[model samples]
Target: MRPFTYEVPSSIQEATSRGGADAAFIAGGTTIVDLMKLEVMNPSRLVDVNPLPMLGIQMREDGLRIGALEKMSDVAEHPEVVANYPVISEALLQSASAQIRNMASIGGNLLQRTRCGYFRDVFTPCNKREPGTGCSAIDGENRMHAILGTSSSCIATHPSDLAVALVALDASIYIQNGAEERVMNLDDFYLVPGETPDHENQLRPGELITAVRVPRLLWARRSTYLKIRDRESYEFALTSAALALDLNGDTIRDVRIAVGGVGTKPWNLPEVRQALAGKPLKPETFAAAAKLAVNGANPLRHNGFKVDLVQRTIVRALMNLGGLA
Candidate 1:
């Protein structure tokens, strides 16, 4: 890593004050450190937010409020998160290895970059790394790239397991910049890689993510996360699904669905959710909605299997959560 100055901010205000254009906020340093070592990212300053006040898991009248700095392992194993939002807990557990989760922070996880090989290598042309340069994954090895939310500029998929679960649950991000604060839906925070693939999210300059609020949904307790990968552990997903269902008898009352490893961002499938509303929790119902999961998909040569794989994964996740599989 290149030479850089590091400062530990004792408060959120201090953290944001120091984090500006060429400065980055580091919580666990899991993502930022890797990029730095690769020389893909070189910030002049690093503002450490670990000592800040944003570091707790709490329950409030609104919903489950998870502090931004809370470790992934801790949040996954927390009584409230594990018992109430199994999807969230499962996503975190199924993420990186035990050691990485112990060190990675929730906010950092949400802001994590794509895992596209071309994007990480400085030698390759990646629109995400250098805008207008070009995207190597477009015509190269793109089996793990995105099918949905892809533009001619880039097709790298957002690699956040936690983001899929949170987006499915309609979570909101609490952000603070200086003394002002704002809240935005977790789904709205991520941007599709259109012409400007470098502009990834809706985070404002000098803003710090404080916490994520997951509103308590009656059906969330019956939620689950399913990840399909080449191997069992420490592998990024090829196609993953996060599903929550509220069933009335054998019929579905309400459902939420978000997919990962298939989109430029954590993808929400509202059409699929709408299709399953009031429908019987049967194989036919799942198969029909699963088809809609790939409604706008544009698959590459080698990644065409993902079109069908994502659909099957969605059906399997829903069935497993609803106890119909």
Candidate 2:
């Protein structure tokens, strides 16, 4: 890793004061360290935010409030989270490895960089790694890249399993920039590559994520996070589905779904919701609605399999959650 100055700020104000383009906030050092060793990221200073008061996992009548610094394993293994939000728990348990999960923070997981081979290997021309250098994955070995929400500038699939589940739950994030604080929908926090591939999120300089809140959706209790990958353990998802359903007898009352490993961001399917709402919950309904997931997908030469794989994964997740298989 490159030599850098480290500072552990005692307060949020002090940390925000220390933040800038040349400085980075480190909590678990899971993502930051990996990129640093590869020299893909070279921050002059590392501001430790572990001491700041961004810690808690509270269940409220309004929602489930999870502090940004909360460890992934703690949140995943919490009694309330496992009982009330199976999707969140499963998403965490299925991510990384048991050891990494024990060290990674909730906020850091959401901020993880893409696992695209080119982005990690500084030798390659990855738009996400170095803007305007051209995306090597576009015409190279891109079987693991994205098909949805992809731009000519970048085709890297988002690598956060937690983000996909949270997006399905309609969660929001609380952010602080010095004294000002604001909340934004989790889905909106991730920006598409459009033209600036390097600009992945909406977090401005000196801003820190405080917490994430998931609105109380009792139906979310009947949710599942299903990830499909090459091997399984410690592997990234090729296509994963986070599905929750609200059923009235045999009919669907409501549904929420967001897919990962196939898009530039956590891809939510509102059209699928529209198709299933007030309709019967059956294999045919699921199959038809799942097909709508690729409405605007632009599959490339190698990743075209994702187009069909994602739909099948969605249908299987819905079936597994609904017990219709």
Candidate 3:
């Protein structure tokens, strides 16, 4: 590890301006600390923001608002989240291990970096790690690489299961630049690995994420998150699906779907959602619409299995949620 300055900021304003541009904000230090040790990410300074009072979960009339610093375990176990946003709770519980879930902050998890071997190994050349350097995962070992929203510069899969669920809810993020506050749809927060694969989000320097809001979607109570991995525990998903359905009698009223472990970001299937809406909630209905989830997927050499895996995962999630499985 490199020698660095450490500062504890009691206020969000202090935290944001505590260190240089290379300074990193630390809440639980679950992701930042590990990457620093591996030399995958090394900041000149570490600014601790745990004491900034970014806490509490609120059930507002508009939505369920979650503090950015809230632990994954706490959010998952919160009765409001569990009762109203079942898929969000399920996704959090299925993420990492119990110990990690207890310590990892919700904000940190949303910003979790790719787990691609080439991206993590500093010795290897990766576009995500260092721009202009070619992505090794593209031609090298890429079984865990992305299939959807991939570019020539990168094919790394997003590793956040919670993000997948949030995507399905069409959540919004509340951000702060000192006192100035703004909110944006969570879907727009993440950027694709277009020409510049290094830039992942829209967070400007010193901007801090304050909270996340999930709008009041009554039908999300009938939602579920399904993940398929090589093993199960303490593993990243090979294919994960998050679905929220609104069924009117035997017909689908509205639906929201997002898939993880197969995309550069949490992949939302608007086409699939559109196809399933108003259609009868049947086995064949789900199986057919699920196929649209892979409309423009560009699978690489080793990760071609994801093309089929994601579809099956989506079908299973929808089936289980609709009690057809």
What lDDT score belongs to each candidate, Candidate 1 first?
Answer: 0.93, 0.93, 0.91
Worst 10 residues of 2 by lDDT: 316-325
TM-score of 2: 0.99
| lDDT (10s digit) by residue, model 2, range 82-144 | 988999999999999989998899989999999999999999998888888998988899999
| Candidate 3 lDDT tens digits, 97-143 | 99999899999999999999988999999999999999998889999
**Candidate 3: worst-modelled 10 consecutive residues by lDDT:** 12-21
Error of 1 at 134 (Å): 0.4
Give the TM-score of each candidate.
Answer: 0.99, 0.99, 0.98
Candidate 2 displacement at residue 184 in angstroms: 0.8
Spell out the clash pairs found in candidate 3.
none
RMSD of every candidate to native, in Å, equals 0.8, 0.8, 0.9
Per-residue lDDT of model 1, residues 109-177, tens digit only: 999999999989999899999988999998999999999999999999999999999999999999998
Regions more than 4 Å wrong, model 1? none
